[model samples]
Target: MGRHVFLRIVDVVSNFDPYFQQRFDAVRRKGLSHLQKCTAAMCMLAYGISADDVDDYVRIGESTAVEALKKFVSNINTLFEGEYLRKPNENDVQRLLQMGEARDFPGMMGSIDCMHWQWKNCPKAWKGMFMSGHKGVATIILEAVASSDLWI
Candidate 1:
């Protein structure tokens, strides 16, 4: 990975505790450190790379790629709840609005957009959910903030 990209990711995730550490400590009575697994998953998500590409790019086995992806999704799901779908509260939304107003973009609670990404060799069964934008390619769903510029 490029130094800038690595540093940026480190900055994003450095404050959050890894879910695996808590689980490992509780169950095994010892922490299981798999920095490779965490880094591979982060790289794949951040870059929107496929598992096979991540395996090759990160120099890890394909099995590790699959496991990392699974663990990443599982851990994230555990942190979210309810029908609002992990949205910020009223106070947080107000703060964001104030921030946007200060930045001269008012009335923007948030910005929503989508992108179509090419998915070569996609399985037939999963094509429907991924199609978008003149059917050009598979689409990965993304949502982000306009003020803070955070991806969710």
Candidate 2:
């Protein structure tokens, strides 16, 4: 089951740009390969696996799993800043609005929604940020443009 899940994740990530692979290569030279660390971190994040349970799931030491999770987050933040998550200019916003209008949905600059994600072990200091609606453990914000047909 673990192997199947890991392979499925690999398939999904493989479709992303090669930037992630290149960054992984650089990180791999320092000792732990990116695949190992990323797989462990993703397992925890996606499957709600506790830090203690990661060892049983991924065959790594508990300490190593913790370190991998930390490194995964740090590396992702660095790469996100480098590759994506840019500040949009006025022109870009206007272009997006125009595109939305072209699709017959004027005045709909964008759509906003939130998804609830389970939080396994949130810290007390950061619980508020992760709070969600009833039966929701955590939330993630999502925004995208909608077309006249309600397609996004």
Candidate 3:
């Protein structure tokens, strides 16, 4: 991510949970910047990387990276659960059915789909998780359900 976008994410995260704020620890150098912590956490989650793997790139310790991951998940659950992660209700289902009809997919309330991606740079031990075939390349597949009105 670009510096601006990363900073924007750190800003949002810090606003949601002040634990991401930059601060000095008791006996060490000043703590990692919120940007570093957030970036490390994002990398670990996005790539399913081990905490130790983020140390060199993000200049964070393994333990701190893990801590950041835990806190980041907690804060996201706390801050955004209500609006973005909510389940669709009856009205949303009705609207989706209408949209499907207009789109010539009658009776379909929502669409379900999946995407497969190669994980070429994945770490050796982690490749098994994404390995789905004998191609010797790791891969991941993402599945989602959504409609014109909501992701549900």
Best by lDDT: 3
At residue 123, give the lDDT of candidate 3.
82
Give each model's whole-structure lDDT. Answer: 0.62, 0.62, 0.83
Looking at model 2, the pairs that clash are: none
lDDT of 2 by residue, 32-149 (tens): 4446556778888778687778777667678878876776666556545543446656765687678779878775566655555566567778778877664656554455544344
Can you tell me which runs of candidate 2 are displaced by over 4 Å?
1-33, 116-120, 124-152
Compute each candidate's TM-score over C-alphas.
0.53, 0.58, 0.70
**In candidate 3, what are the lDDT values of residues 100-141, reduced to their tens digit?**
999999999887988777776788999878788846678888
> All predictions: root-mean-square deviation over Cα?
6.4, 7.1, 4.1
Indicate the worst ten consecutive residues by lDDT in candidate 2: 15-24
For model 1, the run of ten residues with the poorest summed lDDT? 14-23
Per-residue lDDT of candidate 1, residues 77-150 (tens digit): 55434422477878768887887788788966667666555666568898887787656677665545555655
Q: Name the TM-score of candidate 3.
A: 0.70
| Poorest lDDT segment (10 consecutive residues) of candidate 3 | 79-88
lDDT score for residue 150 of model 3: 60
Q: Model 2 — TM-score against the truth?
A: 0.58
